[model samples]
Target: MMPLNNSMLITGGAGFIGSYLINQLIVKGVNVICLDNFDEFYPRKSKENNIKSFIASPLFTLIEGDIRNKELLDDIFKKQTIGIVIHLAAKAGVRPSIINPQEYFDVNVNGTLNLLEVMKNHSVQNFIFASSSSIYGNNLKIPYSELDNVDFPISPYACSKKSGELLTHTYHTLYNMNVINLRFFTVYGPGQRPDLAIHKFVNNIYKNIPIEVYGDGSTSRDYTYIDDTVTGILAAIHYLEINTNVYETINLGNNYPVKLSDLIEIIEEITQKKFIEKKLPIQMGDVNITFADITKAKQLLNYHPKVSLKEGVINFKKWYEKKLV
Candidate 1:
């Protein structure tokens, strides 16, 4: 396999997964242009700090812009010879989507459309989009697969993601673009969004605050580590390169579901602090479980998640403790 070209664009590169991917790409000697507007969902300083390690790197370029800004996108596309686009920008969160559905649609769906249009205009065909397993919304099946029926997405966020997949398919069909939509399961590790369960729990534990235990603690998630997820993303890039066929969607997850209670115990073990649990009713747009069927990813992209939840939590705790200090 030939080395990836120097020029690449990673939308939302300031966010959790995006920052990690950019760091890995830079280490591989690839020039990366990161586009992010620093949405208010998280602290701008957090996102800013996330990319500080790469700010001085000659291979890294930061563009403070939104994906919704069509003119900015057009300008970047026209100026840069971007070989691959990893679209990870989106208004991420399930319960938040319930309160602001339109906003989620605008960012996740419309913003995605703008990116696709600019890519098509610039002839940048190779693409990898950040899709979510939330698209499987309340799926009865234990482990959801790419072939599973995903027509019934409950939350607005899930609907928007599914729409993005459809839009990507349309672009691939019309322009013969090689697109891969990676339906990521619950991704967690250092730099996780504060809104996410693991991060919030870790923070609360350190602060001696009651950790909100939504639902009955029976809910489970296939928590994929950041490194493992990045590996899958890299594999998807290669997969598209090797098989320049139409569009494809694959699951990037550990395929192991751990109950909420189990996760809390792991966190407790790592932090050595007992969490004051505050039980709350299940919030809207929150699913009971998410178990990814990674068979497709394993076969197509040669993807396999390596990090276990216990190890992942320990790593996250270490990072959190350092950050607090």
Candidate 2:
């Protein structure tokens, strides 16, 4: 990989995927500016600890702010000379989005617009938007494709993501900015967020708490490990180095869907502990399944995921034991 000439700004840089990506950049000695508000979606301490590994590095600059703050974004753009922007900040979670639709839109949709405007002003065209598979919603499609109709988002979070993707498209159309909307599958692994199933299940199982199962354990997710997802993102970032003035949306996933029940069993096998299953009703915004079709990612970005669910679960379990337990 060629050396980066200017700093890279990663929105929500302290969060799961962001933190991991930052560590990778740090190892490469790439100058990085991490912007995160430490949203209360989870404890701020968790996010703080995620960056503890490289926060003190001279290559990294941490900004404590929100993406909605356009003035702050502009100020950073004026100072940092950022060559690329990886927008990952958002009010995540589909179920919570059902209760507070406005917050989701405010942070995810409007906040994204703020960042785009700032980048437009700065003339920093390279952008990689961290989109979600939830945008697929309850589409009858088995393996969701980037070309599939993402117009039917069931939850506010999904809707906000779809809106962000559309807004990115519009910015690309008008400004001729380079944009790649990566529709990430269920990303899991070390430093996984607390609310995610892999994180929660491992914690609850370890503490002998009841592990909740929604939708009769039939609903499945295309779980892409954090390492794999971050690789695709880095590829997308480097892609702008060779490809320019284009708008593209690609799916980055394991291209494998594992049943909810099977996921729990995998966890049990890894931990050598049985879970007290508490079957719950299906979530309102939850989709029946999320299976990614990564053909476009492979063709364009040469994105290929290496981690399997079992291997990813074991890696996460090792992390859980070392960090939380």
List the global CA lDDT of all models: 0.91, 0.92
- Candidate 2 Cα RMSD (Å): 1.5
Regions of candidate 2 where Cα sits further than 4 Å from its true position: 1-3
lDDT, residue 150, model 2: 86
Model 2 residue 274 CA deviation in Å: 1.1
Q: RMSD for all candidates, in order, please.
A: 1.4, 1.5
Model 2 TM: 0.98
* Cα lDDT for residue 274, candidate 2: 96
The per-residue C-alpha lDDT of model 1 at residue 290 equals 97
Deviating ranges (above 4 Å) for candidate 1: 1-3
Give per-residue CA lDDT, model 1, range 1-325, as digits (tens). Answer: 2236638899999999999999998898889999999999999999998999999998999999999999999999878888889999999998899899999999999999999999999888888999999999999987998999999998999999999999999998999888989999989999999999899999998898998898889999999999999999988877765665648899998999999999999889888889999999988888889999989889887787889999999999889989987
Clashing residue pairs in candidate 1 are none
